[model samples]
Target chain A: MVKHCSVFRDKTELEQGVAKMAELRQRFKKVVLKDRTDYYNTELPSVLELGNMLDIAYSTLIGALAREESRGAHTRTDFPKRNDEKWMQHTLVTKKDDTFSLSYKDVSFTKYEPTERKY
Target chain B: MKIDLKIRRFNPTTKNGREPYYQAYSIEASEGMTVLEALMSIAAAQDPTLSFRRSCRSSICGSCAIKINGFTKLACSTQIIPEHEKAHEMVLEPIANHTVLKDLIVDFDPFWKKLDKVKPYLMPPETQPEGRTKEVHISEKDAEAIDHAQKCIMCGSCNSECNALEIEKKYLGPAALAKAWRFVGDVREEGGRKRLGRLSDDHGIWDCVRCVHCVEYCPKGVEPLTAIERLRSRAIQEGIKDNHGAKHVEAMVNSVKKVGRLDEAAMTFKTLGLLRSLGMIPFGLKMEMHGKMPHPHLFPQIKKIDEVRTIYAEIKRKNKNAKKKPKG
Candidate 1:
C-alpha cells in the first residue's frame, strides 16, 4: 500500500506566516511614521523574521525578476519593459533543500500569444 | 460610444416552440456603469420582460453570474467600459453545465445537489468537556488557508468553467470539492475519515481531470484545483484506493520518480499488475488497437532524466518540510 501524507499539514506553515505578517506591519508602520526609510537598511534580527513572514514573497520576486514584463500582478519597476523572448514560459518556483530555485514551465498558446501587456 | 448588447431572451409563455434568440439593444456608454447596471437599464427602458437574476448589485451574494464575451463573470462586478469596447459587443447568457431556465437564468438544482452530497458542515468530536466552552484556536496562517476556502459563494462560475463538468456531469466540480476541503481542513471537525470516504468514490474526488478552468474562472482567489490535489493526497494518506485511478496515479508517479520520466508501457503494465484474470489484457489490447499504447521495449528512454528526477526530489522535499511546520 502506497502511503500518502496529509495535505492539512499546510496549516502549520500558515500559523508561522501570520506571526511574520504582524511583525512586518509593525516594522512598516514604524518606518513610515518616523520618516526613516533606511529602517530596513539597519542590520536587525527582524529582517530575518520579515523574510520568514514573506515566505511566498520569493516566488513573486523571482517571477518578477525572471519576467521583464508587467503582466498581470508581475510588475518590475527596474526593467520598465516587457521581454517576451526570455520569459514567455511560466516561472515555476519550488523550494529545494531550504532554498528556493526558479524553473521555466511551458505554457499552452491557444488564442493569444504574449504581446505588449497593456492594461 | 454605442455598444451592441446581444442578450439571449426566452419567454416561456409567449415564445412557443421557437428557439431562444438574441435581441440587440444599443446603449449609450456611461461612466462606471457595470454590465449588470446596463442590463437593468435595458430591462427598464427597452424591455421589462427581459428576464435575468440580480439581487445585490455588489459582487457578494454570488447571484447575477453570467457569461460575458465567452468568459464567466459576475455581471454586477464586471465594469462594461473597456472590455466590451475591445470586443465591440457583449454576449449575455446563462451559466453553462446547467439547464437554462429562461434567458440569463439557469436551474441551480444540480449545483445544490452536489453541494449537499459533500455534506458541507462541521462534525465536531463527541468528546467535548461539559459546561467548559472554549474558542477554537486557529492560527493566522491556517486562518488564511481557511479564508481562501471561505471566499467561495457557491457561485456556479467555477462549475460553468469546469472542463470536468463538461465531460462528466456526475463528477462533483471544484466548488463542491473546495467546500469539502474547507470542512476537511477544519481542525475542529472530527469527521475527516467520513468525509474522505464520501469523496473516494468513482464520480466523486477521483474524477477531476485537473484541467484548471475552475482555477481561472473563480472570481475569488480560491484555487479549487489545489484543493482537489490536496484531497487526492489526503485520500492516498487514508489508504482509501479507488479501482484503477489511484493505482494509475501511483504508477505514473512512481514511474516518473524511478526512471526520471514516464515509461508509458511500463506504467501501464505496473498499473495492470500480473493478474491476467483481472480483465486488464482486453483493456490493453483495446488501447493497443487504438494506437494509444507505446511499445514496451522503449521503456526507460527519455531526455533530461536527471533534471526530471531532481525536480521531483525538490518538490517532495518542499512538501515534507511544509508538513512539519505548525498551523499559523
Candidate 2:
C-alpha cells in the first residue's frame, strides 16, 4: 500500500491511492471482529490503529492532490513549476464524516523564506 | 524481496489464552522500508487482529519500542534491510522487563512509575519582586550541557534492558536519573541543591550498577548512565554524602590510592564503619568458607604503582584547577 502511495505522480494516481485506502479500511473493519478482543471505550485497539493509519494515508493523498505546484520533496509531472503566489501556505487536510476537507494555513516565515530549488 | 517475520503472538481471549507463541508471515520488502512498515503490512493484509503500539512513525513518540533479535530498538527507526541482509528469518519480541498485555503491546505503568520519582517537572520560577520585571535567559552553553539529556522521549527501551533494574526493582532506572540530570543541570532551578539531596536518597542515583545497558539500548542518543554519573557527582559536590553508596565509592578510591590496589578489608571498614564491619565478620567468614572472599593479608601492589599514583595526582590537579576557574 505504501509502495502504491509512493508512485503517486499526478491527480489520478492520488485518487487511486485514496480508493485503495478506502477499500483497505473497509476490509479491516470487516475482518477484525469486536466480540473476541478487549475493548477500550467500545473500540478494539487494532481497529482503532487501522483507522488512524487510514486517516493518515487518506489525508496525505488529499494534500498531494491539492498542492498543484512541484515543491519541496513532492514532484508533480503535470505541474512542474514552484508557484509561490498560489501554493505558498501550508496545506492542512482534515477528514470529517468520510470526507477529506482541505484548508490552507499561513506559513510562519522566519528569516529564511521559500525560494527556487537550485538543485 | 520477501522476508519471513516470526512474530510473538498473544491473545488473552483465545481458548488457550495467555500462552504466547510465534507465528511466521512472509511479507514483501521494498527500499527504505522500516520494520514497522513491514509489520503494518502484515497487520493489514495477513491479519487485522495483529496488534502493536505506535504513534509518530518518525520515532519521536517513542511508542514503537520493541526487541528485534534480542536487542532493544524502536521498530520505526530500525530498517528491515539490515536484518534481511543477515538472515532470511527475523524474530520479533516485546521488550524485556515489561509485562506484555498482548502481541507487541507491553504495560508501561512500571516505566512511568519509576519516572515519577525524579519530580520530573521543574519548580515554578519565583515571581518578580514588586514592579521590577526581568526576563530570565539561559546562555547557549548552559542549554547545551543538558541538551543531550533533553532528547529522551521516555521510550522505556533503556529501562527495559537495564541489568540494574533486573536485580533492584526499586532502583530509579536510567531514564529517571537522566530526567533528574535534566532538572539538576538547569540553571533556572533555584532548588537544585534540594533536588540533588532528594536524588541522593535511597533507590536513587547510587543504585545504578553502571552496566551501560541503558546507554547501549537508548533509541535516542540519551546516554542515561552518563547522566546517572553526573547526578552522583552533583550529590558528592553538594555535601550530600551521608549514604553508604557514596562512602563505599570514596572508600574504594582511597583504598586504591593507598595500597595501589583495592584493599577489600579497608574499603569495607571505611564504608561500613567499625560496628557494621565487626558485625559482618561472620558473613566474611562464610564468604571465605565459600572461597569468594579475597585473602585479606595478601594485597598485591600493581607493577606500575608509581604510574598509577602519577595519573591520580594529575587528575586531582586538573579537578582542582577546574574548581578554581571562574564560572561563566
Candidate 3:
C-alpha cells in the first residue's frame, strides 16, 4: 500500500498494487476497540486511522487504474501518449464495492490557449 | 537516524494548568520524514494516546501547526532532520496563546470567532461592472493582490506568534486581518469602505503592533503585517480618519518632518490634542520619575535634513508611479 503511487509506474506495478491491496486485506484483521467511547482504550493505532488509510489506498489505486493516459505526473508505459481528444478533461472515479466507475469534466480554458510543454 | 522527541502533553478533559508536561520518545526517522510523520510514527508504535489534529497529510489542511523549538509551524511541511539542533532532540508543544484542548490540539474557538468578525466574504456590487450578462471584470493586477492574500491557509502560525494578540486578546490577529485584506483589496466588493471602517475601529487593524512576527511565521508568505498596514493606509486614504491609530501615525510623521526627528511631546499633543495630552500627565510624571523621559534638548539638527525629505519625496513618487501601472 505504501509503495503504490500514480507517478512513473507502468501496468505491471499497478497490477501488483491491486493484488497487494487484496493480499493486505486478507492478512490484516480489522481492529476492535475494547471500549468504544474511550478514545485511549485501544492499542498503538486506533482502528479509525487504519480504516482511513485502507480507504485512501484503495481509492488511489482505483483512480490510477481508471486513467489510461500519460498526463501531469501520471506516467503510464501502457498508454505512453496523451489521448487529448478523450482525456483532455479530468477523470472522476468512484468506487462502490470492488467496481470502479469513471466520469469526466471538461477543462475550462480562459485567456491563454493550452500550449505544448517543453519542460 | 535515531531522533529524540520531547512532546508537551496537556489533556483538558482531565488535566489543568501546571499539569501539562513533556513526554520523551525515541524514533527512527528516515530522510525526508516530516515532523508530522515522526509524530505519527511514535503514535503508531509507542503510544496510541498521543493526540494531535491532522488531515490531508499535505500542508493544505492547516491542522498540524504546533510549536517546534519555540516557533509555530506546520508539522506536515517541517522536515525533522533539518530542525535537529541538540544532537537529535526536538521539543514539540502546542502553539501559544490558544487553549490546549489535549496533547497538541488547541481550542480554536477564539481564532474562528475573530475570523468571523472580518465578514470574510465578498459583498458584490448591486450592478455588475461590464453589464448584466458579463461577470465582474477585475484587472489582473487587482486579482493578483487578492490572490496573494488568498494563500493564507488559516494555519494559526501567525496568530500563535502575534505580539499584539498577546497583549490584546480582542485584537483581530493576523489571520483575520489578512482575510479582511482579501475583501478590502477586491474590486468587486462594494463594501470596501464599510469593511475598512470596521477594521479601523479599536481592536482592529490599528491594534497590530507591526512586530512582523506574523510575516515571519506565515507559511504561505501572506505577510499579514503588511496587509494590516495597507488596511490602515487605505482607511486614511478613504478619509475615514476617526481612529486614534491613524491620528497617532499622522502626527508622528508630521512631527518627524518638522523636526527631522520624533518630537514625542508635540506628536502626543497633536495626536490627542491639549485636553487628552493633559490627561496623560500622571503617566508622563511616572516616566519622568523613572528617568526614562530625560529632558530633551532640540535634537541636533540632522546633518542631511534635505536628504531625509528627498527620500520621503522619492517614496511618495514611487507610490504614485506604482498606482499608475496596469496591474496584471
Candidate 4:
C-alpha cells in the first residue's frame, strides 16, 4: 500500500492504493487484541492507532491521486509541473460516514506568496 | 552469526504472575546490527508475543534503553553482540531499578516522578522589562558549564544504573540531578540559589554516593556525576553551608587540611556539632574502644602535614583569582 502511493504515485497507482486501503480497512475489525491485561499494553494502542493511520494513508493516497501536481511530496510522473490555479490549495478530507469526502480550500497567505521552496 | 538472546519476560496474567522468567531464542546477527534490531527480529518472526519499547532506530528518541549483558545501553545504538562477549549468550533484560511493565519495557513512572521533583523546565526570568523583549545573551563560559548536561536525552540509563537509587529510591538519581544542573548552570535562569537549596535537602544532591555508574553508562557523555559535583560546588559558593551535605564536605576538608588525613573524632564534631552529635556517643564509643577513633586533641601527626595545607591554599588562591575574573 505504501509502495502504491510512494513508489509510482500516478493516477493508476494511487487509485489502486485507495482501493487496497478501503479493502484493508475492514480487516482491522478482525484483529483480536492479544494483550487484554493492559499493563503498558503497546499492542492494543498500536492496533487502535492503525485504524487512524489507515484513514490517514487512505486520505494521503486520495489527495495525491486527485492533486495531479509535483508539489512537495506528491510527485506525479504523469503531471510533473506545479499546479497553482486548481491544485495549489488544501485538500480537506472529512469523514461523515465510513467514506471520506475531499474538499478544496484556498491557501491563505499575503506576504509570503506560495512559491518554490528554496533552501 | 547466531547468538542466544535471553529476554526476561513478565506478564501479570501469566500462571506465575509474580515470577519473571527468561526465554531464550537463537537470533541471526551480523556486523554492526544493533541489539534493538535483534530484538525486533525475534519479536517479528520468532515470537510475536515478545514485548519491548522501541522508536526511532537512531538513539535520539531514548526509548530503546535496556540491559544488554547487564550493562544499561540504548539498544538502538548498541551492537547485538559485543566483541568481548563472543561466546554466543547475550542476555537482554529490562533496565535496572525500575518495575518491569512487560518483557523488556520497564515502567518509567518512578524515574519521571523524581525527575519532576527538580523543576526540569527553565523557570521564566523574575523580571522581563516590557520595553526590552529581546533575546538575552549568555557568556560562552556559562554555556560550557551546562553544555554536557544539556545533552542528556533522559534515557534513564544513569537512573537505572545508579547505585544510590538502588538503596534509597527517593534519592533523585543522577539523571534528574544532571537535569537540575542543566537549569542551575544556566546563567539566564533566575531561580539561582533557590533551586540549589531545594536540591540540598535530604535525598537530594548530598544523597549521591558518587558511584560513577551514571557517568559510565550515559550513552551521551552527560557526566551526571560531574553535574552533581558542580551543583555541590555552586551550593557551597552561594554560602548555603548550613546543610548537612555542605557541612560533611567542610568537615572532611577541614580534617584533611589540618591532620593530612580524616580525623574522625574531630570531623564528626565539626560536621554535626557537639550538641547534635550527642546522639552518636554510643557509636563513637564503639570506634573509640576499637582504637579506630583518633583523640580529638592528641592527634597523631601525619608526615608532611604542611603539604595538605599547600593544596588547600592553592585551591583558595585559584578560587580568589576566579572570583576576580570578569563576568559577561
Candidate 4 per-residue lDDT over residues A2-71, each given as its tens digit:
6798845688888888889988888866777665665666666667778899989888888888887888
lDDT (C-alpha, whole model) for all candidates: 0.73, 0.81, 0.81, 0.84
Q: TM-score winner between 2 and 3, please give it.
A: 3
TM-score of chain A of each: 0.46, 0.77, 0.70, 0.89
lDDT of 4 by residue, B77-123 (tens): 98866732663468888999998877888889988898899999897
**Considering only the true interface residues, what is the Cα RMSD of candidate 3 after superposition?**
5.0
Which stretches in model 2 have alpha-carbon errors above 4 Å? Answer: A1-36, A40-119, B30-32, B84-89, B124-141, B286-328
Query: Could you give the candidate ranking by TM-score, starting with the highest?
Result: 4, 3, 2, 1
Best by TM-score: 4
Candidate 2 DockQ category?
A: incorrect
Supply the TM-score for candidate 4: 0.82
Tens digits of per-residue lDDT for model 3 on B213-306?
9999888899998788878888987888876788888887776666578877767777787899899999999998997653436556567788
**Per-candidate alpha-carbon RMSD to the true structure:** 25.2, 5.5, 6.4, 3.9
- What DockQ would candidate 2 receive versus the native complex? 0.18
The per-model DockQ list reads: 0.01, 0.18, 0.16, 0.27
What's the lDDT of the predicted structure labeled candidate 2?
Answer: 0.81
Worst 10 residues of 1 chain B by lDDT: B9-18
Clashes of 2: 0
Q: Write the per-residue lDDT of candidate 2 for residues B175-260, one digit (tens) a residue.
A: 88899899888866667788888888888888888888999989889999988888888788788889988898888787777678
- Distance (Å) between predicted and true CA of B286, model 3? 4.6
Weakest lDDT window of 10 consecutive positions for candidate 3 chain B: B9-18
| Candidate 1: regions farther than 4 A off | A1-119, B16-18, B129-134, B270-292, B301-328
